[model samples]
Target chain A: MNIVENFDLFAPRLINKKELLSGGHRACSGCGEVLAVRLMCKALGENTVIASATGCMEIVTSMYPTTAWEVPWIHVAFENAAAVASGVEAGLKALRRKGKIADCDIKVVGMAGDGGTMDIGMQALSGAMERGHDMLFVCFDNEAYMNTGIQRSSGTPMGASTTTAPAGKVSMGQKTWKKNMAEIMVAHNVPYVATACPSYPLDFIRKVEKAKKVKGPSYIHCFSVCPTGWRCPSDQTISLGRLAVETGIFPLYEVENGKYKLSAEMPKKLRPIKEYYKSQGRYRHLGEDEIKMIQDRVNKEYKKLLNKVQCLEAWS
Target chain B: MAKRVGMEVALAVAEAVGQCNIDMAAVYPITPQSHIGEHLSDLVADGKIDAEFVTVESEHSAISAIIGASGTGARVYTATSSQGLMLMHEILPIASAMRLPLVMGIANRAVSGPLNILNDHSDIMPQRDSGWISIFVENGQEAIDVSIQAFKIAEHKDVNLPVCVNIDGFQLTHMVEPVEFPDQELVDKFLPPRVPFASLHPSNPVTMGAFAMSDYFTEILKAKDEALKNSKKTILAVWDEWAKMFGRTYKPVETYKADGAEILLLTMGSMGETAEIAIDELRAKGMAVGLVKLRLWRPFPFAEIKEVLKKAKKVLVTDRAVSFGGPGGPVCGEIKAALYNEAERPAIYSYIIGLGGRDVTVGDFTSMIDKVNREEVNTDTYEFLGVRE
Candidate 1:
């Protein structure tokens, strides 16, 4: 069990109290991505500036004449949040050194959704990370582009149906496996890279705080469950995220300074992947054969991750 | 004391920008704008300038980075040319709409297809509707002077718009000439540190670049339009202040030898100086020819253009970039629209000239005048100055 599992919603001690995101946002019901953003903001605290890409979060929070952001937030375009955040960080560095602004530790954050991060925004993100900017980029991966309807993005998992890649007579929904965005960020050799889910609030918050303190670039990939797009009951959002972890569909881990550390204890006898798949209507069309195929693929990928962790451990 | 030294125009512009005490610059290298970025980077690296020079991966990121920096109330700068400018086209209007008050130096060049990296207005012409306060420089000195003035004009309280200073690629950017740089103290006295209207900070957090729906979209656009339109007053005031301090006056539409001229040849960018030579030669031959140089592009100087062209009987409008099939050229198209409502407009002929580094010499100007005079008719459309069949 995780800290989130032991903590109560009405309790006072765990998460920070500052409300960086106002409650009046226009996100759809049971939006795990918005919850993740809220949790991330809480971890960021007061001295943070966010550059958001055009996505569900941006559209929902910033509808002219009104804003749900209690923090300084900027939305420049769809794919350049990372680039913009790099600029903001550089600007702050220059300003502070020149004594133009107050000398304080302010974190620059770039926030985007799956499509913005995995597809259109890949280049800018890679550049910012490579430049070693003191910033963090958070990609709220809800599998597909939910803001403009359920269009399949690079982050969309195979066997999950979407508007663009629907389950038709000859198609098996998304054609390819979900991209390992965390591994990709690790390849950038950024100081910190983490995979988190808002369902585990403490885990996500801890990773964000760790990233906040990193002097160089950091990345956090949040698995945001979209009930509206996933066609699941609103109440199942949290449980389904848990099911994903337990079934080896999604794992909770962090790589800090090239060291792999699991955020939570790996479930001892992984649950069947069918439990996670059955919770979402997106994968309802998959037959037994397709389910077995996905199950085998998940196990193989999990083993690959375990091999990485073990190899690093053996060296230590 | 101001220092006058022979320097490449691009390097001079970079030195001028460094004098402004800018907080940040995110620029990508693309010729002939590459010199501007390279010099600026050196200035930052060697502690010649106290600014952050972010070497961005692409023009898109360059514009994006500067926008983010400017949102923090820091004066920012970047330079690009041709396809680089096109890469920045997406964020150009966004910058103006947000009113971040950054400045960009454009080494104007032809846009691609054949992919020629040479001097032309094709790069900047397409950015006409991007709501930037654009201006063209004829020489290295003008480039340096206007580059300094750009920060002043952009950071003005009433006119918080990004300014684009266009120096024609290779034609002006590569030209080595003596450019007088204003004293650092004098520059400081003339241009104050940017007083941001609403900067992003933790103490006073604000949401910028908010998405506007149909209900409020028009009003937001209207406000940006009004800002660009009203920027003219601030531009003139800044230039007036510069004249007082530096003894150089600049006009939106500057005229040369037009006191009693009936035939006028209007031009923009670096070609204006070559045409001046042609005007001198033609005047020596007892011809009544003059020049109207377009200095300001956007918030298009309609009144100033009309006021200058009203007295001329025949006008030869030279545009450096073609407008495809729409109109003659971007500048000429705007000129035509500007004079369409006038009570008695002059007979106008537009020629797409000096494209893709095709040199427009003194002879070319004389030939264009001859072409207009020999063809006794208003050119409803433009003709390529010397493009072969």
Candidate 2:
């Protein structure tokens, strides 16, 4: 199969004049979240509305009268991105019916950070999806509350040190495991749920394209690397995202109509988890035992995911 | 001609909102407020209203979704009770700041500690500073009237702020009463299609709810305050036009038999109706007492309140919520603040009553009046009218 040709079929034409997200915002150099948002906006095109939660992205992109968004965007309070998107979709539908607006296809997108998504925003996200609103909810998971000074979030991986969960004599960084948000979204039985990384633009773009075409609710869990929050060199952001997937820590996959498919094939012999862990300063304090624990957890989870994908393949 | 019909207050509110020809409604079910959502959904499902009814999971989501829809230039509505109202509190200010012109029905209920879901003023009092235009309803007619007018007042070009209609939960919301449903033609003429001030559209992109720094934050806040304060003009104008069309007059602070009265009582929401009865009873006994009902709660009718209370020798203010060791009740506190600098003022007395759905009979009002007349109340603090202790 010519996979590249298939990818091109769904790929959005990148137009300079129609750039939905403009440059010259206040995002830090090598910020992974902004990069992911740029690609996401390109995929969504001009016929889209974004409801961004209060975070680094919202704060950076929109400050007073100046805005980086070329398309219509709203930033309500934190924890209501999905709810806002739900309203946008509903409002557009009503307008179209009344002939107040042309019947142009418009996609509503809800954008939020890890803390906003897994912590404060969970209820609204779940509600919007359960109601089956025609919208896309993208969670840019940076693993911590980077906008609020790098506090530990529910999405922060276990043994990863944050300002709130500092590595000390008695403490071993974050105590709990990262909540599986993609799986939780799938449990909602939404029409489309996918995991993508900005490191691989084609995979991320393709997932967003598929999500846009889906009739009902779609969730995209985008793995956004935070160089500042993770205490890594700015230039290593993309490489860190690539390492996260290659090491079996963050796999790329899509769940369409409850059928799971692994989009990025994993190597038979996975790279050591230490390659991804040692590269970032947040995981620098981890002992040998902690690394082994994380390795065991990642390997186990990967095997379970592979089994599910294989089982679905057999059924098909 | 308008027709009188008997219906549950919540359903009447729903029907009135439907008649306004709103584009969308996002609702989350909560006690006393759920009936409005149910009726609106039914109206949409039955094809009586050409609108989208999104049954959201929580009040927080409901408010958020309506914000989005309203931002998209679609007239939207939502309803909530005490806890649910509290859940939507964070975004309430945003809706006003963004100037979305969304209409909300708040069935006033007691805030939880004892987990009470009954009628009280605690729910709407906290939202006083949220920058939305708030109005209190005394009965089903007012519930239907204020709800329909809320859309007009909020969407008015001059006052482009959110509006909340507060109806006493269970006390007024669940009560079945006679209401006048205005003709569809009249409603359509009164409220035209929403003319969005700055709506979200691909053809005309605009950023809303942008972050403000210290250089412009205070100025932005000042602008919002000025917008709310100026909204009073639009509110009164809308009420005047409504009266002209519907023949039902409403005032910011409505007075009942206050002429030449020595003692006066003030109340808000459904308690005003009970207070009116008490005033009649007091009048029969030849007591020089009358009642003042506060309909407008936010951008408080300060001048109107002062003008009415200025004539009385003694004013007794009744509040449904406590201020918790502060100066008396919230309403009484505002009244005192409003009249503090005046050259001459009535001797004020604050009475907290009807908390957590506790019944306040006419007798209780009369006795309370008697206690105040005899100088029996604690002058330093507010008296709880019906507390057992």
lDDT of 1 at B32: 86
Candidate 1 Cα deviation (angstroms), residue B144: 0.3
**Could you tell me the lDDT of residue A100 within candidate 1?**
87
Fnat for the candidates in order: 0.85, 0.93
| CA deviation > 4 Å runs, candidate 1 | A1-12, B376-378
Candidate-wise lDDT, in order: 0.91, 0.91
Off by over 4 Å in 2: A1-17
Residue B234 Cα positional deviation in candidate 2, in Å, after optimal superposition: 0.7
> What is the alpha-carbon lDDT of model 2 when measured against the actual structure?
0.91
Please report the TM-score between candidate 1 and the true structure. 0.98
- List each candidate's DockQ score: 0.88, 0.88
Candidate closest to the true structure, highest TM-score: 1
Q: Write the per-residue lDDT of candidate 1 for residues B100-182, one digit (tens) a residue.
A: 89899999999997999998899998898999999998899899999999999999999999999999999889989988999
What residue pairs clash in candidate 2, if any at all? Answer: none
**What RMSD value applies to candidate 2?**
1.9
